[model samples]
Target: MAATSRPKLLAGRKVLLLADFQFEDLELMYPKMRLEEEGAEVSVMGAHPAGIKYTGKYGYPVKSDLCVDNMSTTDAVASYDALLIPGGFAPDYMRRNQAMLDLTVAMADAGRVVASICHGPWMLCSARRTDGSPLAKGIRATCFSACKDDLINAGAQRWWTASSCRAGGPFITARTPADLTPFLHAIIDEMAK
Candidate 1:
């Protein structure tokens, strides 16, 4: 009998995940695990200082490997193949930092994978490219129903899709926690590419 093969589709790929206070527990954890299973290295960065623990809305906790402030160098940022932003109140807090927004824009401008789930899309709506263009502008997107208006106001085009819609760059988004499976799969697919 033939042995089953395990897929390490994202072997050698590095992914950066952004989180802060009140991140969605499942949104951050699910991707970290799933992506690792596929052989991707995932780094969690907090909007605050490094080494501090951040709690999710449901009270789950995650330690920050580094602060977003430390990802300043071109080489440091360039090492990542993709970025993941998990939803929750975290987006509301993370979105306030210029570094977080700049990082999002840089990842998108490079056409790398930029994925956000649920309220995570708030970062997408807030990021601005070097050209002064809104990151959400002219992109097909979907998010939590409450955020629908925010995206629209930010110039994002609405798309009804089961999984995710392409962002202003090589972006993807899911509407809620229920969509984590599909959202995680979308991130894997893009990173795999």
Candidate 2:
């Protein structure tokens, strides 16, 4: 009747990559590659069925590993140790999907780490889980600075403004693609714990 514990680091962790039409290419691929290098299994999730072709903000094409519709929400995402949301227009698209939001909420509630880059945190805001709540209320996290400012200037509330802010919960947000290395490291570290 004793509880079993998860492994340290991502020796055998499963990471869910969620995206839409246009996502930061480097931000998505780099972390996915890095996590795989560390013995983690990486899978792609998109709004389309046949699979989503990712485009950079500048319009360069990026290929995906799989489609969201190809796998069941309860199957593809349910067992992952973490969720990675790369920014760009993708998170915006993802925000509209109830299934994606539910998966994110479930991960955070389970105390699993959720890593996001660039405007990726926008999905967090859409999930309504970034409102200084117990899940991500004040954790030292960060996200794309200009985007955060734009949200504020546009009168949007519930966005993180710092370059790197952690809200004292399970969320980890970073400002840009340049923050990927550290952000992925942090996520790996958290999952390892």
Candidate 3:
């Protein structure tokens, strides 16, 4: 007898996830596995030393498959179909890495889906366009309340939605872990495009 197979809506899609210490575990894991389940290739990259495990804010530890120290932003942007930034205090540390910032912008410019949740939008606030403007400028999205001002200062408008917000272009965002399921759905929808 033949078995049924789930539809691979995201087949051939590649998603790049940025990670660091204190990342929101659910925000990272949900998307990673969901995307994979839908047939997308997901790669985890972190700023920590190669092979070291980074702990999330809730004490969940996940090892990164790639180290940011040796990462090539250009190669990364060209290689992936989308980029994801998981929220937590990890964005506090990720925002300090120039390569991660560059890759975030490049991916957006390349017409790839760029999704962020909770405090993850912090990384987006730090990214810049080729013309030196803020990447988040003019994007309409919702994020954790604490990061609201940063996004506003970056020229983004507030979107008061409980679920994940999927704006046109390469932007998708959510407010917190409670929005994870919807956020994952948004990413899949965007990549399927």
lDDT of each: 0.83, 0.71, 0.85
TM, every model = 0.92, 0.76, 0.93
Judging by lDDT, tell me the better candidate of 2 and 3.
3
lDDT of 1 by residue, 1-193 (tens): 9989887999999989998988989999998998988999888998778889998889999998988887773654579999899888889988898988988888888778889888888898889877777788888888887888888888888673434544435878888878887777778877777
RMSD of each: 2.2, 7.0, 1.8
lDDT of 2 by residue, 1-193 (tens): 8987654457878998887777888888888888887778887777676445767776766556666556654664467888889987788889898777767777777777788888887766666444443323344555777566544443334455544534346777788777777787787777777
Best by lDDT: 3
Question: Which parts of model 3 are misplaced by more than 4 Å?
Answer: 1-3, 160-163
At residue 139, candidate 1 shows an lDDT of 83
How far does residue 157 in candidate 3 sit from its true spot (Å)?
A: 1.6
Full ranking by lDDT: 3, 1, 2
Off by over 4 Å in 1: 1-5, 160-169
lDDT assessment of candidate 2: 0.71
